[model samples]
Target: PAPPGEGPSLERFTLAEDELRTVRLRVPEGTSGTELAALCDDLALHDWLLTTVVRMLDGLRLGAGAAQDAGTVVRTLRPAVDHLLHLWMPGARVGRELAALWDPLEERPGFTRQWQVLVQRIRDQLTLHAVPAVHREVDPAPGPPAVLPRE
Candidate 1:
């Protein structure tokens, strides 16, 4: 294979509208089977993650009380937090020949950017829920503190 970026060329296009998203990619002529398979795996992984997160967000009822809503959100998103959050390593396994392919998708659809925003939204929800707990923990003892017999 030619040196990285010298020979291999990648073309990527994405069409995202309403409930449908389509991605098109063209890889250099000499791309190997392993590289092509790896690219497919990478793309499929992102597609699944995107779909899962969108569905999770859609199912959440944002108008519920903070603590209750947070419990629901945590319950809903637990799978993503435990199983999928750490799976965003794009191009980590792709060959040099096809690594450039991700650049176009990143430019057009901003896959990583969207994922980061979604993850942050989850964290913000959890943090917002936690604030009440923290406040309760810090509140002074109710009524009056019993006078301590001389320490």
Candidate 2:
């Protein structure tokens, strides 16, 4: 049962800017704990990527102009790297029936692929900030510079 009025099996909310946004996904009735955990795992992945990663990316992008506030970028995103990134564990706990739910998401849109892109962008931003100013280069290599077009 969904402990006292959780709205619905797939309820969701963004509590605040810093905390992880929540998605109260309820497993189908009679689903095993393992099944529920699997469902939770999927929901968690979606929440972290949608809520945290996107927000961090937006912040990093907006703050990209203020490279001086690299510290702020660090302050804003370090916790996510330290705490949130490791939470992804896709089909681990899902029940057999629920396993199919992840398909369309991983198809053309590619949920994990999108997440990977966001993760790399965030890491790149962090790396850019972490480098000392004198050592930082406009374009790291001699070739045409690669860039992640803003989303």
Candidate 3:
């Protein structure tokens, strides 16, 4: 097997859409397979969530023409609400050694912040197209209309 590449990638996450998702990590030399697998799963989840958010954002661009075809914009964003909203757990499973990797990312250009903004935008867009149910006011019955007699 070839030598492991350069620095501690912390972890490397690769997603090929429908084809594959690969998470490669560098742990201490003697770490057990179970530990490695756990790390990979953790990294993969983060990658998938991040990737999903970017994809969701890509569908949201309501400009001048939005007023005409508003429903389509809302429809485009619903999948992110249904599928990607709950997947954010930053470094939840990462060990102390590599937890630092999440810091720079969580700062300045924050992933979680972007995810929140995207979700909110999706919700707001949908709201823009939603029609509220009309409530009609009716007067109280007046003693069954004085017991109408058959003509």
Candidate number that wins on lDDT, 1 or 2: 1
- Cα TM-score per model: 0.75, 0.57, 0.56
The order of the candidates by lDDT, greatest first, is 1, 2, 3
- RMSDs, each prediction? 4.5, 11.0, 8.8
- How far does residue 150 in candidate 3 sit from its true spot (Å)? 38
- lDDT for each candidate structure: 0.75, 0.65, 0.62
Query: What would the per-residue lDDT of candidate 2 be over residues 97-145, giving only the tens digit for each residue?
Result: 6675565456745668877887887788788777865476554678886
Which candidate leads the pack in lDDT? Answer: 1
Judge candidate 1 against the unseen true structure and give its global Cα lDDT, from 0 to 1. Answer: 0.75
User: Distance from true position, residue 117, model 2, in Å?
Assistant: 0.9
Which lDDT tens digits does candidate 3 get at residues 1-151? Answer: 1145433344444547684876455555555666556656775676667677667656666755644355566567667777777777877786665566566556745767876776687677667656421222455676656766899
lDDT of 1 by residue, 1-151 (tens): 3455565545444446764545455554567888888977888788778778878877876645433555676788788889988999988889887788788668867888989999998777777777877887896878978997996
Clash number by candidate, in order = 0, 2, 0
Candidate 2: regions farther than 4 A off: 1-41, 61-64, 133-151
Q: Ten residues in a row with the worst lDDT in model 2?
A: 5-14
